[model samples]
Target: MRSTTEQTVQPCPQCGTEIRTDRRFTTWCSACDWNVDPVEPDERPGRVERMRRGIAHRYGERLLAEMTGGESRRPRRDVAGVLACTVALCVHGVTVALLLAGVLLVTLGWGGALPVLGAFLLGLAWLLRPRFGRLPDDAPVLHRADAPRLFALIDEVAACAPTSGVHAVAVTAEVNASVSTYGIGQRRLLTLGLGLWEITAPQERVALLGHELGHFAHGDTRHGVIIANALHSLNSWRYLVAPIRNPSGLEVILNALYLLPFLAVQGVMMLLDQLTLRAAQRAEYLADASSATAASTEAAVALQDRLLVYGSAETFLLRESNARQVRDRAKRDEPEQGLWDRLAAYVESIPESEYERRRRVGALRGHSVDSTHPPTHLRRACLLAGPAEPAAVRVDAEAVAAITAELADARRVVARRVLRG
Candidate 1:
């Protein structure tokens, strides 16, 4: 009795199992992948203007999207923070206004009402303010002065993506690469993990560079700071006024008065955060597309696939490699060519089925509702959506090799550097 379309099912693309059309999962393949998609090419920043509710400029984002000719249906997170910042400013202005009004009332010989209210608001604001600080500058950083060759390579990557020049690059023990903007117009900090670089093949490394450069290209780094600060500032405000213990009569009444209004603002911010997170994930997809355009798709795929395997295995490899430098210098007779090959060899010994299982679990999770970054599988899917481009740039072999040699010493000094702290 079912219609033809409803009854029909397509064979799984990867494993040829029947994908049920009648079910909610029409395209998903259980025996193969949970994620199935028709990824469209996109460069449009996002529809963030829709999020500006009070005196919202609804059409501005539409215009931007139309102008860009590509879009992913998620509100831009950083731009949404503009509303948060606006709310913060308004709250601050009101507090200042109350104090000034109170002063005027006292001068005019009015009762203490205005001054008392002003003092209360100001004190609440101060208490509610959140605190955060940047990572220590003393953390071992590699400057252009020390690693010109590496800087040259980074410059090459930036040029291909047409992004701003990196101000400083640092090597870290973490297995990741990140570019962060310190302030609105501040010099961007680029951190490349020795673990990721040590494991990446030359071509695959280009993909990683391209993806990170794409983040710069799209201003994701700059905007990310704004969104983070906005969220933190809001939390600070809430913290300043929230009752620490169970509220007694006066405390309960005061909390109800103070927190009720802010609760609505917090709820709005949370919703905005979710929307922006989706946008951030989409930004990641767009960045992956940029990576595919910069390097070969194979390179991007290889990098992602390798990253999955390297996740658990990498921690072990980095620790062993770092520990070996001091503990077994006598045993390490071989000239250090970097730990990629040996680490990879060890990972390859892992069953393919096991790797697939791990990849599946991670991919299925995608990005959490609040996560600002997308999952690796989502990135892989996005890269696959784009047609492969010929490698647009090559990492300078001489420069990279020289940098790697320097990084070995950098790694050796990392523990000691931290200890110096």
Candidate 2:
């Protein structure tokens, strides 16, 4: 670790990398791995860093033991998140109750002076209730019948992880994989990315699946979805109360009734959202360890490394270049192998520093209070330090062979879908 406080950085003579003078000898250039010497382990991680890493590793170890026939346990729920949803629901309930009471008594008893207002409030409350439905998805779903090998892989991962199983599965063109809940009832959906499959080895693919399954192991989304939906509802009203259109005198007065209290409550909801994010971060750390336990440490670490590379600017450039090639060659009789070759070549040419930037940015895994996951660096540190726990099972070579072939087809299928878009 180097002192990042100093803003001035001089260029490395060989690699043209920016470097602070104090760290020049100890810190390597990420692009070229250029340095005077390797940093000693003791000097790198201080006491507080060691404690956090150790705790994360311990959580992973417990989850790994559970996967190995120990009793299945529920990860703690996010109380703050539930409370946020409760507050949101209470707002809707109170508004509805007041509307009903007003319409039945005030409007009727006051000679119909406020009948129109009461009716309007009733409609507004209906419009603002938490619409407990999943958003529509355009990505193509992969059925077990259509892709047995893929399904087999999914099923195997599901059995090993601490989840009941996903409700649906699909593949996409992105370089990432995710497991999410959809619809009003919180059904699960698993999404696999073709780009990751194209680059990953069989073992690495297992690591990736294990990570998504890990999210389910902790019920990260199903529980957090409430807080998310609550925030979405509140934010929706926040904007709804804004002067989106010119207000009539009567509308202005009604808006004041709704807007003032909503603004005050909206600030409180934001605070709760951050408070509830802690559970998500814990889920992520344990899940990272789960990935390592399911796959080998080697495979898990490799998959994580590739993820960093996947986020780098170089990857974006490579993807666009490949896509442009695909479009250009759409009508060509040229071999498809050439396109794959070109893509591999471009990615191999990128400097290591581009990937390092992803690590420095902490990728999507940072432990920011607002984020659900710990940084990829922290997760990896914990995992690498853990006591040995070999993978429970490796799919037989024949099954691995079958799935590997299916993986290739998946890449083509996803690319074609992207092409259509």
User: Clash number for model 1?
Assistant: 4
Candidate 1 global TM-score: 0.64
Candidate 2 collision pairs = 134-183, 365-374, 365-375, 366-375
Stretches of candidate 1 off by over 4 Å are 1-135, 221-225, 241-258, 313-351, 415-421
Full-model lDDT for every candidate:
0.58, 0.60
| Best TM-score among the predictions, by candidate number | 2
Query: In the order shown, what is each candidate's alpha-carbon RMSD?
Result: 11.1, 9.4
* Model 2 worst lDDT window (10 residues): 363-372
lDDT of 1 at 5: 38
Residue-by-residue lDDT tens digits, candidate 1, 1-421:
1123334467877788876643322245557564443333244322322232211223223323432455552335466546555654554454456556555555654565765665565565455333333433655677778777777777776777777657777676567887775544556778777667766677777788888877877655225544555565556655665554787888878877877756765664555554454445456665665566667788888788877755566556656656776765455554444455555555554444344555576654433211455556655665665456778776667756787776666665553432222
